[model samples]
Target: MSTALVLIMTPGLAFFYGGMVNKKNVISTMLQSIVCMVIITVLWGIFGFSLAFGESFHGFIGNPATYFMMKGMLGNATWKAAPTIPLLLFAMYQLKFAIITPALITGAFAERIRFNSYIIFLVLFSIFIFSPLAHCTWHPDGILAKLGVLDFAGGTVVHMSAGWAALASALYLKRRNEANHSPARITYVMIGTGLLWFGWFGFNAGSAFGANALAVTALATSTTASAAGGITWIFFDMLRGRKPSAMGTCIGAVVGLVAITPAAGFVTVPHSLAIGIISAVVSNLVVEWRTRTTIDDTLDVFPCHGVGGMVGMLLTGVFANQHVNAGNTTGNGLFFGETHLFLVQLLAMVGVSVFAFFGSLLLLKITDMISPLRVSAEDEELGLDISQHGEKL
Candidate 1:
């Protein structure tokens, strides 16, 4: 049940990203998101989940002890106040994280990559980069989790990792044809936004496991900030004399959603507002600034997910209120003036960004040995869907 929800959940991300690309690329766009579901799901079953959550090694990577489901999982609430779902169920849930992390990378290189190279890259990225980061950050006794960093769902594990990986992939892949001024599919994008907004409640609140008060709090805060983010973006667009485009509203809503994820369970409804506002500005600036550079992040993943993740992680430090979680014994926030936690949060963000950036670039360089990273220029001009898949939408 959980795994299915997890799988269904990421397709919404497809809509969110697809809508931002040109209609000519919309089908191809959705295909990338769907393809991630297929490739990552099989790999997760093969060994991705195992290497990530199976067993720890030196506070970094997992032992791959559970490879090919060779060993069974612990089956119960084996860790702290974590969920008590069956181990396989837990594995499946984590698989969603693995799949979606790669899916998020598409936002950076969408409408450009050779489907073959993209697939190979996803396979390599998960086994090498994503699995280890997840193991180190999310596993019980994991170094980052133990280091007092705040990430309720995946500010670091999913967003930062995907964002940085997207960065490396964007650089490694080089440019696509007419990559500039590639228009987005506003209708599909809006649909994706609504889907993301719906599914995100499951994403954030469900991280709580029992559907308790924290889940409620997370859901409420998630919605409040997304709404605020949409309005915030609209406020800016209107000021600039452009119509408050649907695309802008959805993007803003997404920024708000990303901003609130880490702090949802940690802070109150009011703190949610501050997080949404601050993150909206940062993400907006990043998307605008990064696009002007030579880097062709086909879809701007680094700015939205990467930058938004940092904002959320940092805000969690200032706004987190432990009174909300009497049971959350391992972590505490800087709210009520516990300023020390803020430094810890900053360190965690810096560490994640640096590690993801370097690690991703290394993976790209090594993978280049087996296959080229970018699509042929001819293929890019024709569109990835037709050139790669022999079908154009």
Candidate 2:
């Protein structure tokens, strides 16, 4: 059930990214979002899942020999990380996460990347970037897990990696030639946001690994955070003298979802509200700040996902309560008279940011050598829809 809901988020993302680009590149933008679903699915089935979830290797990555080609995932055995469910089900659930991670970076280079080159990057990122992070954070005996770092879902593994990669991609790819333009379709964005909002219940709640109190709490927190984020962004926009915008609301809501993901099961409902509002405000400031710069992070992925994920991780360290979930291996936060978790989260954030940013930069350069990463100047001006995919609507 949860796997199905999470899968819908990719198409939701497609529409969300598609609507934000200009008409000339709309189809190519959506296709980038959708294609990862196809490519990553195959990669995950082969060895990606093992690299992420198989037995540990020096506390850094999983041992591929354990489940290469998913050799031992069949039948009714439960996974070690999530006991009580079929092992295969757990693998399927994580696959949804793998698909979306690369898809999210598409927004940063939406209009100027070569389609074939993007396909290569998608595979490379899943193996080198996403898999190692997932192993360190989510694997039972991994490094961050041993350090008591808490990421209920994937603030580090998914959002932070994608956010840093988005920044790297924007910097490496450089600015788009076309000037900033209006969204091609506000209606498409609205529809996409609605789909994303609906699917997020599964994204957060399902992380609980069962239909239980924690899942219910996560569901409640997800709803509260998104609502708070959306409203807070509107107020911030008003303060800046810009009219309230449909696109702004949609982006804000998604930001809230990203912010709450790491902290949902650990923090209480009230703190979730704070997480949403503060993250929205901070991301809004960053987006505004970005306008005066030359870095073309086309859709503000770093601001909304990277910075928002950081805010959530910080707040999780601040607001987490041992009483909320007794299963917490890490103890309470500073508010509860402990300072260890907060410091650990900071270190983890810095480490992951360095890894993802430099790792993605290296991947971009490597992939460029294999195949030029960007479209030709003439093809870019002609638009990716006509130049790369040879299709238009």
Please provide TM-scores, in order, for all candidate models, with all chains considered together. Answer: 0.94, 0.99
Error of 1 at 325 (Å): 1.7
Question: How many angstroms is residue 224 displaced in model 1 relative to the true structure, after the best TM-score fit?
Answer: 1.1
**lDDT (0 to 1) per candidate:** 0.79, 0.91
Clashes of 1: 2
Q: List model 1 lDDT by residue over 322-364, tens digit each.
A: 7876644444566666776678789989998998888888877
* Overall local distance difference test of candidate 1: 0.79
Q: What is the lDDT of residue 257 in candidate 2?
A: 94
RMSD of 2: 0.8
Q: Give the runs in model 1 whose Cα sits over 4 Å from its true position.
A: 1-3, 67-70, 73-83, 182-184, 330-332
Question: Per-residue alpha-carbon lDDT of model 2 for 1-393, expressed as tens digits?
Answer: 888999999999999989998998999999998998889988888889999988899889988778888888777778887995898899999999999999988889889999999999999999999999999999988898888889998899999999999999999999998957888999999999998888888788999999999999989999999999999999999998999999999999999999999998998999899999999999999998888899899888999889988988888899888887777868888778899999989889999999999999999999999999999999989989999988988
Which prediction has the highest TM-score against the true structure?
A: 2
Superposition error at 93 for model 2 (Å): 0.3
Model 2 accuracy (lDDT, Cα): 0.91
Q: What's the CA error at residue 187 for candidate 2, in Å?
A: 0.9
Clashes of each: 2, 0
Instruction: Indicate the residue-level lDDT of 48 in model 1.
Output: 81
What TM-score does structure 2 among the candidates reach?
0.99
